[model samples]
Target: MQNASKITEERINKGSLLALAPIGVFLVLFMGSGIITGDFYKMPALIAFMVAAGVALMINPKESLQNKIDIFCKSAGDPNILIMVIIFLLAGAFGSVAKAMGAVDSTVNLSLSILPANLLVTGLFLVVCFISISMGTSVGTVSALTPIGIGISQKTGIPLELLVAIIVGGAMVGDNLSMISDTTIAAANTQGCELKDKVKMNFFVVLPAAIISIIIVAIMTSGYQSASTETYSYEIIKVIPYLAVLVGALAGANVFVLLAGGVLFAGAVGLFTNSIDLWGFIGAVSEGMAGMQELCILVMIVGGVIGLIKHNGGIDFVLNYITSKIKSATGAKIGIALLSSIIDLCTANNTITIITAGPLAKEIGEEYDLDPRKIASILDIFASCWQGMIPYGAQILTAVGIAGVSSVAVIKYLHYPIFLLIFGIISITVDFSALKKKKTH
Candidate 1:
């Protein structure tokens, strides 16, 4: 028994450190290369992760090569990873098809014509926030809004990457607080809080940040060059694709179903407009799926590797370390926030990070008499803050790709996430007496 206990302790520590190694590798490769070259493009994120993921395998026990390979394969092919891959493919197809069909340009021109120049950034920010709240996913919101943001930037002479960042920031706000968000669900469930209670607590904590972000975006874009806008021919029918997708998503339609409907609408419109022949449309769809291959591969690698880490007790090790270090309710909250932020950095997926941290956070919450809602809010806030700022994150990467600019450029102009960090810190340090009172009622 003594020998077994000693061995178990050693495994816990070693596995915990090994689990962290991939994250360190990723950060060094991506951030180090960017720093060396003075360009964020110096290292592609997927390549860095691929290398790190391979390294993670080396830390596994001296097992049969086939067994290890099988382990990796299983993680790489998890249902969640496959789902994200499919979404990436469908989204790519829809984006391409929509663009080819002129919906993107028409939507852009229409947006520019409607929103006044002064309210451009403010309007975009609000729209992104609202969409993310309704859809409960930042990636979905970013996909739907980024092209529009890019169009707005081109038409108005604003920096395209910066505008994309604005949309990304707003989307993250909703991702953190939205009732239907996966992050929200994970946090609430882990902390034993009702979803509604968590959302209410988070609403107060993030409200100041939201308002501040709007003010900052408005001020920054106040000098935006206004171009003479022309009204779109207004393909009212084409607009139905986005409207249907949005409404269906809000109605809690399955994501795959929602995406399928959008894909069908976009493809049908492409057929109607003669943008491409049947063969051409099929080719576009195929190419889109091909485009997502790398992303899909990466997701599988991460999921599988993370699964092994969990199986080996790395997660438990970390949770024990953090929980043992907490002394007060305030410290517990801060620790939960920190835990979620660190996990977000590693996963590059806010929802997954929240899920990883949720159970641990709940135990801490109960021990400290901390409100489950507050704990949930803390997890959501820091995760969103970190995820929004990471250049290699899905939302930022997609936005950068669509905007055709440097990720650094986008990061530099992202004032909203920065403001949010400040607001979150303040809220944590000083209890908002009024907000607390409102919540009690």
Candidate 2:
């Protein structure tokens, strides 16, 4: 029994680069095929992930096929993965019912009536940031705001993909800094730091990125004219559902409860306004869930594939390699950031990435006499940086799914994530800690 336990531990730490090949295969099939055909839609992400899952199953021939299949299935059915699936379905239902009842159009027209065309994108970025911070969930923010973004795009002719990208970027800002965010909680607890300290540390690093992003978005929309020259009209009643959802989120309601309430309330409004009858409301709910089927399946496949890669030691390999290179304090910070970023790239979930990398980051911080607050900040910031920009991540996927745009098109306009990465690197290279101490003295 002892020998078997030891062997299992050895296999877990037996880092293998070959374990990562399945992801490469997926990228090749998905992006490579798209590049060759000059159209990304030529290759579906679902088909690409399916092929990758097959590759994952083939990697560990020494393990029994049944065991491998069990691992894959276990990952696909993980609690976190299942929760995301549920969120997707509920968000879809809410967005669909709201739109069917004219909530999106009413909200968009109301926004247009208030903000100038040149400031629309900038205003949206700010609004999403505020809501995301209050809600403490980037995916939730994206889910709630994406329909309005789509409506704005159609009315203003401001490139749907770009607007979606802006919404994703703003959502990430809150995800990184929100005190109630899972990533923030995981990172702070794992590093043995106070949540408020971590939030403060993160605020300094992320503030510049957020400010610059606002300026860039403002400039990007400065010369734009609304495609429609006519005045917009709105019904205050149709906007109630969105307002209620936003208020619930800000009040710290559970996400599941908030979404379910949104769906029911939207349906009620639809019925009351005669925008949709009872049968139509039911149909809208079903159609909305159906639209999310592709995204849900892709998420499960990605989870299973990541499970295989981790079981085969792909994540352990990367972890071992990065930790081995740490020679100084700065190197340790970079290692923590890189570890969080790469793991997030594989997992497509920032909260999971932080949980996975946090213990080792704590160890590295102790070894180098580094501040736990900074370590926690690094874990949250870098994870969010990748999570915001990655094409396969939930935030980007949710936005694209709602906006009906390709991930590649949306990625090009994701300025906040890129700026966040830049500011994060700068935070490490320059010692803000010293400056703070100097000012205090």
Candidate 3:
């Protein structure tokens, strides 16, 4: 009986730090080469992931080589990962068709004509926040806005990296707070709380961060001047495709449907305006999908590597280690935050991290008598914070892929995630129960 109990405990706590070495290997090879060369582009992300995937295959001698390959292939073909790849391909097609049909230019011209130069950056940030909240998917939000951001950057002389970072940061705000967002839904359900209650708690925690981010963006762009002296013009007819996609997303239409519709809509407008021929539209789609090929392959490779790490017990080790350190309710809260953060870092997917960590967090919260609303809020906030900042995350990857900028360059301009982190920490360390009571009175 004693030996059986010991075996169960060991199984529960099973994890190996060596299982995580592939990630370290990737960071060192990718980021290290970038640092040494002073250009991240020198080391392609695809090569780094390929090498990391090799390392993952080589580890865990207990598993047969064929089994390891199967694990990698299964993870690479995971439904979520495959869906993301499809989204990337579709986003590329839509962006290409829209740009080819002059929709991007018309939209940029309309935006520039309406918003003052100094307020363009701030306006873009706010618009993205509203759209993302309505859309409830950060990747979708980033995909839709990145082309416009690139257009603005070119016209305004603002750094492309900064503009793309703004889009990503704003998207993350919605990812954390949107009622329909996967992260929000997962967090609330895992914590056994109502979605509305989680949203209320989450809004209060992130509102200050959003406000500060707006101010910072305003200040950063205050000195901006347009790089082009030429006046911009727009054709309202050409802008319809972008408008359709935005409206459809806001209405909670399926992303795949919206992208496909956007592509066809843009092509129709192009044909009507004689902006592109039928062959030209088809070529544009091929071009767009080709552009996304590298990113799609990199995402799949990363998925495989992450799969091997999880299979080898990397995540379990971290979970056990963090839970072991909790000594109080406050400690438990911090532990939950840390767990979410680390898992997100490893997986590079916030929604997945929340789903994986939610049960453990619920267990910890129940033991410490922590509020479910608060627990849900923390999980969403921290996961979003890490997701927004990580270079490998889909949000940042989508932004960079669209904007044609390096992910590392954009990280420095990501203000919202930093502010979100600060506010998240403050919410945990400082008790707001008294403030809630005072407000009620």
RMSD of every prediction = 7.0, 8.1, 7.9
Which digits, one per residue and each the tens of the lDDT, describe model 2 over residues 1-441? 123233334445567999988777876776677568655446776787799899999997999999999999998887766766776677678777887988767765665567666677788888788667644578877987898788778877788998999999999977776644567666776676665667778888788898999888888877766564657788889888877876775566766788798899999999999999999999999988897788677767777887888899886675555545555678879988888888777656787667556756775675566788889889998999998988877898889988889999999999999999999999987754432411111
lDDT of 1 by residue, 1-441 (tens): 123234335435443655667657876887688678755556876787778767767765666656767777786676655655666566666655655666655554455456676787788887677657655568867877887776777778887877888888888876765644657655665565666666666676678878887887787788885674655465655656666765665566665666677777877877887766788777777775676576556556666666565555566566556545654556767887787888777556676566556656765565556666777778887888888999878889878777677778889877767877776777676765343522322
Most TM-score-accurate candidate: 1
Q: Which stretches of candidate 3 lie over 4 Å from their true place?
A: 1-13, 116-208, 216-231, 327-417, 424-441
Task: Name the 10 consecutive residues with the lowest summed lDDT in model 3.
Answer: 432-441
What residue pairs are clashing in model 1?
A: 75-304, 76-300
lDDT tens digits, residues 1-441, model 3? 123233335547488889878777876776678668755446776787788889889898888999999998998787766766776687778777887988766765665566655577898888788667644678878987898788788887888998998999999988876655667666876676666567777787778989999998888888886565556698989877766775775566766787798889899999999999999999999998898798678667766877787788876665456545655678879998998898777657786567556766876675566788889889998999999998877898889988888999999999999999999999897754332411111
**How much is 397 displaced in model 1, in angstroms?**
9.2
If scored against the real structure, what TM-score would every candidate get? Answer: 0.67, 0.64, 0.64
Q: Of 1 and 2, which scores higher on TM-score?
A: 1
**Where does candidate 2 have its weakest 10-residue lDDT segment?**
432-441
- Give each model's clash number: 2, 0, 0
Pairs with steric clashes in candidate 2: none
Regions more than 4 Å wrong, model 2: 1-13, 116-207, 215-230, 327-418, 424-441
Error of 1 at 237 (Å): 1.8
